[model samples]
Target: MIDFLNSIDTQLFLFLNGLHNAFFDPIMYWLSDKWIWVPMYVFMAYLIVKHYKMKGILIILTVGVVIALCDQTASHLIKHAVMRLRPSHEPSLVGLIHLSKAGPGGMYGFVSSHAANAFGLATFLYFVLDGRLRILKYWLFIWAILVSYSRIYNGVHYPGDVIVAAIIGTLIGWGMSKLFLYIENRRLKNK
Candidate 1:
């Protein structure tokens, strides 16, 4: 079963990676780049402050915490444990993958930290901002999915790696959101 799934993953990776062109390459790279999202982060902070006032600062801080957890767990724990070779580094995929990296990626690519962090922030924001901004719930997931797709297009990770990271990241984000809410409710009760 694992072999079959891996086979499918490679085939899908090739198909998706094959579709990239010069025009879209830079865009995907930018989407996957962490620094490029600074504006988005600032905007998110503004949104939280606008809606929740002083308490909104807490949500912004929690987002950072959530992303840190997702990134560290995915990169340090899961990827090292799995040790799956990146498509760009896989011997079998030589001459087939479109290597788009500025530098060689890590040896293993089991769980993509990029996907984990992006989805983690998205899911956490969706939960914390629940009902306040209905549109953002869908937007956040779509943004996360786009960023995950960029990992496959960048040739550093397979679709399976991104998907697995997204699931784990979402779970982590959900757990954090619940924990935050529970503490908040308890504090309000005490007050």
Candidate 2:
């Protein structure tokens, strides 16, 4: 069963890789890094503040910090400890797709920071702001899924890495939301 599941994952990864190469080659090369993501985060923070006021601003900031910590901890420490090579970096998987420049980075691929960060923020915001921003919750999840797929498409992370990162990110997001909600409710009661 595990082998079968792995095979499906490999096929899914390859399909996404092919799609990216076919349709988003320029975007992948140009807009797939911190430059794009940081501005996005800034915009998201702005929107959160605009909509939710001061409380929303504080929650967004907290979630941003948590996402950054989770992304870096998984990408740097756990990934290095695991030391799983990317498909492009592996001899066996070469020629399956066009490989991107390595860029300045470490040689680890157990979990994709891109996937974790995007999905973590998405999930966190989804739960926290769902009541007020019902439509946005769906868009946020779609955005997270696409970001996760982009990692595989860019040939920097395997299917396993993306999956694990997503799961870990979701869990962290959900946990943080619950924690914050509990604290906020307690404060409300006190008030």
Candidate 3:
């Protein structure tokens, strides 16, 4: 079962990577600049604040911090413990596509942080926000999916890496939302 899943994941990764390179890669590369992330972070923060007020803002921020921490920790563990080489660095996978230049330390690639972080934020926001922001939710999902695809398109991570990271991120988001709601209700009862 695991091998079957892995095979499917690899094929999906290749398909998505090709699609990303053909369409979304250039746009994401332009937008993946640090400054762009900063503004996006601020905008997401603003949305949380506007929708949920102070308590919601705090909860969202806490979730964001936790997600970031989880992303980093998981990436570190997989990179160090697994010692998996990136697809781009693998001679077998060479000529698959144009790969982005490697960063310092020859970082190991397994779980993708981009996938984790983007899906983490998207899932958390979708869970926390009430009412029918259906369009926004769709867009968020799209964004998360696209970001995950970027990792493979850049040849920095395997399909398994992004898939597991996405699952982890989604679970974290959902769990945090429930926790936040419970805390809020308890506080209200105490008031």
Q: What TM-score do all the candidates reach, one by one?
A: 0.95, 0.85, 0.80
- For residues 23-50, write the lDDT of model 2, one tens digit per residue: 5865675445667667766877777788
After superposition of all CA atoms, the RMSD between model 2 and the true structure is: 2.6
lDDT values, one for every candidate: 0.89, 0.75, 0.69
lDDT of 1 by residue, 57-169 (tens): 99988988998899999999998888999998999899998867544488999999999998898888888886877777778898899999999998999999999999999
> Which ten-residue region of model 2 has the weakest summed lDDT?
98-107
Candidate with more favorable, higher TM-score: 2 or 3? 2
Worst 10 residues of 3 by lDDT: 97-106
TM-score between model 2 and native: 0.85
Q: Give the TM-score of candidate 1.
A: 0.95
Model 2 misplacement above 4 A: 1-12, 20-22, 101-105
1-191: candidate 3 lDDT, tens digit per residue: 96797578667766755665456556656433445567766776677677668876686667667577657756776667877666667666566655554321155766776777777777877876666455666677888887776677665667898888888778777777787778888999999
Ranking by TM-score: 1, 2, 3
